[model samples]
Target: MPLGQRPGDKSDARYCGVEVLDFPAGEDLPAVLNHSLASAFDFILVPLVDPNYRPAPGSVLPVSASDLILGPAQWSNHVVGKISEWIDLDSEDERLRLDSELTLKQEIAWASHVSLQACVLPAPRRSFCGNYARVVNQILQGLTNMHLWLRLPLEKSEPMDDDLDKIKNNSHTSEIVDSWELWNSFRLLCDHSSQLCVALDILSTLPSINSLARWFGEPVRAAILQTEAFLTNAKGYPCLSKRHQSLLTGFFKHSVQVIISGRSNHNVFPVSEGVLSGDESYAEDSRVRHALTPYLEYIAYLYRKMDPLPEQERIEINYRDFLQSPLQPLMDNLEAQTYETFEKDVVKYTQYRRAVAKALVDRVADDAVSTTRTVLMVVGAGRGPLVRASLQAAEETGRKLKVYAVEKILTLLLLFIV
Candidate 1:
């Protein structure tokens, strides 16, 4: 279920997810998934393969559970696959590097086999990740439906002062090394493939406000909220700080799904008597509260607290963050459909008519309304919406007017004297 229902809101941001820390082995993924869904989480970010397994010759991949455990629809709709974190393609050892690449590919194949919508790749080990980008680019060439999200920390460390004495003494001052640069580099290398996206790991401390704002323009699919990032409330319930709340609101506006990660810090609810850890037989119902239920509840509270989206904004919500190439009206004429679309904005034309009326009233004095004439010019007047507005304004103000409509693309320039 979504956090809350707002009229005209169909954004994915309404959904919240939890990151599964432990592997659900022995065909137990269904029970875990059921419990999480019952706890009100819309989805789960789960490991596709066991974390302990390393690639070996002729050895089958140790997936968490058989593909039959969950139906195709459940896998695609409710699960986000997590690639193994141990795979580091940039490692110095050749054996480790080969194994890492193979494992990454195998896990991705398994995710695709299950028809998972998206998979989160592990963060780059060091600053330089050219090899990582190359492998991902190769994978992207063949993928038809699945999207790959490159996970990275929201901010990295950069040395502010390079004084040798302070550096040697371990007292050198350091500042954030804007992670956007890292993402920018990776995306550029991959030719900015649309299938590639970002999943930011939000820690306890956020970067400067201006630095943080840079992410709003990027293709951020999810924000992984660490459990430690939550501050304890007055009543000991989980809550976010003011800055965190503001950032979360921004994310919600951009349709970025939030995933609660890490161990449960607040003991807001007591565990039932018979439930045991790693027990698949336990009832997967609402009666058994999940450990991360408090955090999820707080997230839902934040979501519900948001004001409903404005009606006009809801109309344009589909194109909110869409990227499009610039159009050149001077070089080529716009299609008739384009002109019709803009002319259909009744609200815009109404405002234009009102403004023109006010200007006409001010230009011609009340005493000279019938005696003096006002001259109005509408530049680039495509389809004459403004021309009509000017004529209406002249009638409303009872002022004699001479109007000129100039459109460069059109062969004829219209002149109207009223």
Candidate 2:
């Protein structure tokens, strides 16, 4: 049952705010209730009027009623944009599934003006048409303009039910390639947003899980994009093999999300216990299963990693950071030749040089009075990328720039000049 309602109350949802938002007992109560984010709701799902039920609101979400669904499991009140899939739109055109303009209009016309945080589509993973790339590009544009998020499926077999029923094929192949391809696609969209996340249904068996769990190379993992995907169907959580469960458990322990589906009015967890109550108290009892069965199960035993405070940085310290300090040690007796060798061998030096040039260019662009030509001196111009970037920036901002490229080994400098 919902938290504050009586046993016979018709409006069954507890955190939905339909009752309060629609028919508040008092005026100040709504403000008082939603004031402290520490006690706010996730999202307030509203009804869409007739003739335009599947309206999309894009990023014009309500400030008081909604906040960005931060870390999924770690919110005070977690509400997301909701559209009733059960509603009969009376149209056979499934073009909304992959049509970018259709998608955009739906998003912009969202009846509730809710930010389209993460859109849930009907099994676009298993069968996207020829227009998927364009659809993805359209979404990528929204990410920058309004910080929209898309919840593309990793694998889906639901739509195959009609054909499968004729042949009665309940079996599934390990869509490992699909997961990899789709994951890679989401990652390749260029990180305008913080992370490129896909929402994967959790009903699949271990082979697919293992494929995804195996280490993606460091360069791929360390790309500007973050692969912070989410998992759904916590009801299927116990189905994973112990090893695969451990793998998912470890991932969610970091700032990841798990969404559970259940009846609207069922008691998921105690209102007093807090939103993400994955703690030690319920480990040995039926309470954990019972709670999770209703979207309230937080198996803290499975996820042992601690989340840092909002004020603190995410402390993902690795062993390499221990060996190599950020501040390079200046050996008192260092030779210039040794320094030159080290500089030449450093793979990141080129990138660092380009970044420095970009920063200098940005700084010069910001300055109003310093109109004299900005002299960019690349100390170790091993390759010409830094010089090119400087020239490009100067051109873009209509600023005068003079480049001075210096290399200790004149052979490298001369070779480049030639």
Candidate 3:
């Protein structure tokens, strides 16, 4: 289920997910999923394969669970596959690097078989990851429907500043690589594939506001909120600091989903404690609530507390990101529907009236207000909306005015004159 029903928001940010730290052993995925859903989470990020498994001759892929354990829709919708973290294609050991590459491919193929919509790639281990970029680029070429979200850390800029100073003071010091620079290099190597996106690992302390603003323009699909980033309130509940809360709010606005990660710090008990109170028979029903439910609830609270979308914003929400062909007024006739939509903008017309009134008041002195009339010419007036605004402005300012409109389109001129 969604976190909450926001009136104008139809984005994925409404859904909150939890990361499953340990592998769900022995086909226990369904049980884990049910617990998370019952605890009010919308999805779960689970490991696709066992972390300990390494590729070998005649060895089968060690997956957490079989593909048939869940339906195709369940795998594609409620679950996001996590690539095994141990794969290090950039390692110096030739055997380890080859094994890591084989394992990475096998896991991705398994995820594709299960019809998973997306998979989160592990963060690159080294700064100079040319081999890593090459392999991911190969995978992207054949990938059809699924998207590869490259995970990157949102490191605080304090260390970056210190590193910058070291570079200036000493020629021997190597400057630290920025996360954005890493992403840029990887994506450029991949030729900027549309399927490539990012999942940011948000830490406890954030970077400078200017440094943080760079990500708002990037293709950020999810923000992994670590549990350690939260602070325990007086009531022993998990809550984010002011900066984290603001960052989360910005993510919500940009349609980036939130995934709660790390061990639960607050000692908040399972959500089923209250419902199963005094019922010993059903107490240990083997279906316990999720420990991270409190964090999800707090995130939902932040989402619901946001102000409702304005009516005008709601009406135009459908046209948010898609591109439309630019209208050439000189080459084409103005459509009636376009005029109708433009005239409905009450605020635009109000501003026009105010500007006209100010100009009238400034030009006509108090003594000349009754004797002399100011001639106002509205060039390229479309159906005389501006003409009406000018007349209304003159009436309000108590100044005499003469109005003339110039329009090239005969159809528009006739409509306004009539």
Candidate 4:
């Protein structure tokens, strides 16, 4: 039924789900951010900007004020605190100077109030030829010990050169580009905090997802594997090339905790996962939900194939926490997709029905009539899933109710009514 394509027969009150906003890099600095919080957004994703990049007198950077966030004012929320990305961080002189130029006094100050997870970034090459150590040390020192994530460049190729020859003669370790030398080098400096991790950026340019496993080098593997996440640039859906899809997913069998990012428009800045999914919604459909299903199922399939969890590990993980990962928690729109009734859909909705019934019930039996008789209205009614959920809730409560679904699309409305 594709959810909203037909009139909803169910009534639900918990249908007013949470919404998160995504703010792209632009002008208006504090205003946009403040507005997002004021609107009660669960979260806001601002593009990573270098707070201290000072272009040479003659040089100009292609960026805006919004792209240059100072240390954020401390607020209590989960923020992916990222370093400011500069346009041109090429050469040793520039790299060495980074230790002096980059500062996070304000950022850390903000973090003391709000929770800043990981510093998301692509490698910050100190020179055309340096391991990730220098840039990493700079972050460690600046943030005073925070988790650092290396989002292996998805489309950009690392500079390649003759392997061992350049090492002695040219003194260039461009060879590190092909493997985990950067991560390894950083390990030598690591104090072994939960702060060192990897965020594999899935892309066609990846030489071999298989190669990454070997590069992990058992010990380093165990340490950071416990501290891993995935990243990808997505359009309406995961921007995985057909050829790389299975190979990439298979490589990270349980890495469904991927952070999906994308450019919002012509300015070519990043947008939040929420906006990307909601903007691409088909009626009430979220693009992210579509993208999440198959991947999570794939992960579950992998889980079913795994060795049983150790009792000690199981004891540490709460029943709910067992599901937490680098990925965001499940935040679905709740309306079932009617057109495609897969086994997963049936399982999902059935569980949701049980939950709604449980959550909505009260000891006051007479109140059920008053509660269920309450009119249900769904604004921007995409397909009819919310309406149906509402109806379901009302029926479960044994209350009389009328549902008014207002949708801007006449064709969609007609389809639902018919």
**TM-scores, all models, native as reference:** 0.82, 0.38, 0.79, 0.40
Model 1 regions lying over 4 Å from their true place: 156-176, 272-285, 324-388, 391-399, 402-418
**Total backbone clashes of model 3?**
0
Candidate No. with top lDDT = 1
- Tens digit of per-residue lDDT, candidate 3, span 1-418: 7878888988888998888887775546776776677778888898888788888889988787877888888899899999999989999999989998998888888888888888999999988888988999999898899998999999744545666777778855764547888998999999988889999999888888887899988889999999999988999999989999999998888889999888767767754432212222324344565667788889999999988777777656656544667888778888989887778778899999999999999998888987989998988898889999999999999999999998888888887757
lDDT-based ranking: 1, 3, 4, 2
Model 1: clashing residue pairs? none
Residue 190, model 4: Cα distance from true site in angstroms: 2.9
What are the lDDT figures for the candidates, one per model?
0.85, 0.37, 0.84, 0.41
Candidates ranked, most accurate by TM-score first: 1, 3, 4, 2
Q: Give the per-residue lDDT of model 1 (tens digit) for 194-289.
A: 999999999999888887899999999999999999999899999999999999999999999999898878977774312213366565556878
For candidate 3, give the lDDT of residue 142.
85
Model 4, span 165-237: residue lDDT tens? 6766877765344435545555565554356666554433455555645533322211111001222344322
lDDT of 2 by residue, 1-418 (tens): 1223222222212222211112112222233233212232233322121223333556332222222323333222333333223322222455444233453445434522343343333223333333443444555555532222234333323334455555545454432235445545545544423433444444334344445453222112110101122234455333334654564544442323444432223343453221222222322322223322323222232333323222212222222112444432232333455445444433355565456557666666566526657777877665555566667666656667788998666556765778
lDDT of 2 at 342: 45
Instruction: Name the lDDT of candidate 1.
Output: 0.85
